[model samples]
Target: MKTYLIATLAMAASAVAQPQKAETPSPEPSRPQMRAEQPAAPKPSRGAFDAMLYVSVQDPSMEWWFNVPEGFAPHISEIKKIFHNQEFSLFPFADNAKVKEGKFSISYSISMKSPDGSLTELVRGAKYEGTKVADDIMVACPDVIDFKLDGRFPEGLYKFFISAKDGISGEISEYENHIRLAEWSAPVPFTGKKLVSDYVRAFSLQPSPEALYSIVFSDDFDLEQKGAPNSLNYTYLGFMKAAFKKNMFLISHIRDSFKSLSDLNRAKFILILAILGEKGIDASALSEPEKRYQEQIRAFKLPDPYGKWDPFLGAAQIDMLWGEFFADGTYRPVRRILNILSHAKEAAFADELAEKSRAPKTQAEWDRYMLGRLYKAALKTVAINARKYPLVEQYCAWALLHGDIPEVSYEVLSPMLEHIREMKSPSGGESGENPKVRMPRIDVESL
Candidate 1:
């Protein structure tokens, strides 16, 4: 139940105001370079209209190649293999051009030739106006063009021909480049003793948190047997610590395992899955696992520990609902929160709070208002149930730290933090006199 609340908040802020550096691909000597480095064909002596096209694997990184000298020779040493879901950008720079009255026009066309010798036009006759930067310098109005290699495109080596026409001088410049489109490579499958040994080896190497997250959430990762629960021990401590540092790529592969688990086992995994889901992890690639999780929760017949309500179940549901609201800005999830509140007084207070809430006028306002309400409701749930279920205290700490609401003052959260600290025994024994609970863990070695 330990959350990356502080790290998550920091990441959220940095993501909004920063541009991410492009991912550098590993060296591959076998890849072919683009033919654009060759000399251009002789042009007619009438008027010179020259342009150069530069490619970047990431859109944000295009700025690095934007301001080359007029006679700079462009060379693509190697084109990295791109995943089907990834996107690359093309930037057209006008080296020499003719302009009239500080105005010029440029149009572009892009064609892809597949390995089978069939050609497909990805872009055709896209026009943009150009501005004269100086007496003889002209630049494209919108210099960047993005191409996404989604599912529609097949995996193969593709020959790309990019042509740009100078409308004023009736001259065209073309560049030939090659790129390979591919699918995300799956990890090699491992089970039983191999799984545990490999996982431990990977931990010892100190692989990046992002790399560890990918391995754990990959489709190839699985436990030894279905429905057999385990407990968190020293083995998973490193992985969980690394995973908590990441706030994105929160995908989980535990749905298949959860489907056949016992009531309490399912509930335990669901809570962990829900916490991860709040960070944008996909429960399933295409299916609605949210609906399935909810259905299982409704069928739970276990002893309720938090008075009339099951705090563990409620925590999972609330987390999932909050995640959904953040993703799609849907009001249905907010309405569902009222139904989940066991206390009429708390529900009534939430209802009144929603009723008195003013309509948001902008996107930022909308985010602030909606997120504020959801966190308030989450805080109320924690306050009512944290003392009853020690796990609830973890959830409470997660909410207070990760909510990022400006209205929540330190004076309000300081006491809660102190209370949580007091709940923990110095010797790391059972928290708050509560009996030690065997939380559900994945049994990788058994598989």
Candidate 2:
């Protein structure tokens, strides 16, 4: 079967050490004004539901206009109700204290059931400064206040409305759905390899990360050698990169298509592969996250040429990649890799390049066929971790079938396969060191 894989880039954001398959970043522009034009935001899709809301808390001392009007105060509980799990503190009212005037930036972030939710709208507030006059809250309406949700949110684009009190006065105020309340959700549970396979087949996408690895181990491979040199040459960075990248797709599919299976199947499979691949590599390795961190360090050769604390930046990058990927499905790394693999000839490259190209590794590697091997490794990793990670196995099987590859075998790796078959827990849970895992190595020798 043509293996569909989410080939991970390095874990470290500043992976200066990874063997330089690409060239140095372009030189900084000489003119300051020329560089002043910051990078442009990704173009929104045609006919996409990209909504924005701005919230300005007017002064309590005055008419006390809120982002919403006084009539809608009853719904305040409903609005705040949705954000129960969020680490938010309700700013208490000081009797007659002045309302602080500032723009509350909230990003309306949308994602699929998977970690990689697809779209993020910057909900910007108008130039909101505290106005000493009554109805000062009017300034808040000019733009939207932005609060961004990081993970899977409830299934709906945030809705906006306004309600006001009927009194001697006109509408005291109005409250738009200024604060978008939504959560990021992981994929739901499903059972039976055949059933799961059928789901994937019907969907034409990968499963959740937790699902794929859970199943891959059932086939065959040596878990003991998972991270050993070229037995898989698997690194923590690779897994993280995959998760981060797939999230972009996951998030986009849900946001764009109303969480329709038909729209998200492809994205779902990719997310499952990327996440489970990371879990499998982590589960099989003895040192785990730390070991992975070290591998990235060795590969990239930390500090100096890469910059000080490149390893930290790299780790941050992994997390950040996940955040961005989950926030929107248009991140650069994963999409670029997927684009190449999707379009590349089946058996293109015969050997690694003898002469280096000045292109970046992402662009340079596009011409090479190593992506195929990387995809295979990602697949294998998912399988190996399936036993230890049910979510990984389930999702992998789901993704494989979705992609039209039926009946995968371990090729039979290690006892991990058997362990997965007999494993108990299906509810995917997060496992790994909290703060620090081993670092990864980047090969920056050529740089």
Most lDDT-accurate candidate: 1
Best by TM-score: 1
TM-score of 2: 0.22
Q: What is the alpha-carbon lDDT for the whole of candidate 2?
A: 0.27
Cα displacement (Å) at residue 336, model 2: 3.0
Candidate 1's clash total is 2
**Residue range with the least summed lDDT across 10 consecutive positions in model 1:** 5-14
lDDT to native, each model: 0.42, 0.27
Query: What is the C-alpha lDDT profile of model 1 across 1-447, one tens digit per residue?
Result: 322101001111111111111132111112234446666555435336655554443222222122121222222222345555444555444435566675566777766687788876655676766454332343432434455544556788867676888778788887666767775543433445555445533332233323344444433333233322222221232233324323222223334445544454344445445433333224453236555765554453422212233332444346444433222222333334433322433434445557988465776554444445544555575455445433233433433333321222323443665744322222332222211222222222221
Superposed model 2: Cα runs more than 4 Å off: 1-188, 193-328, 338-447
lDDT of 1: 0.42
TM-score of candidate 1 versus the correct structure, residues matched by position: 0.34
lDDT per residue as tens, model 2, 4-110? 11111112212111111112221111211111245533433432212222222211111111211121210111122223123211111101112224112111121
- After superposition on all CA atoms, what RMSD does each candidate show versus the true structure? 19.8, 24.1
Q: How far off is residue 25 in model 2, in Å?
A: 39
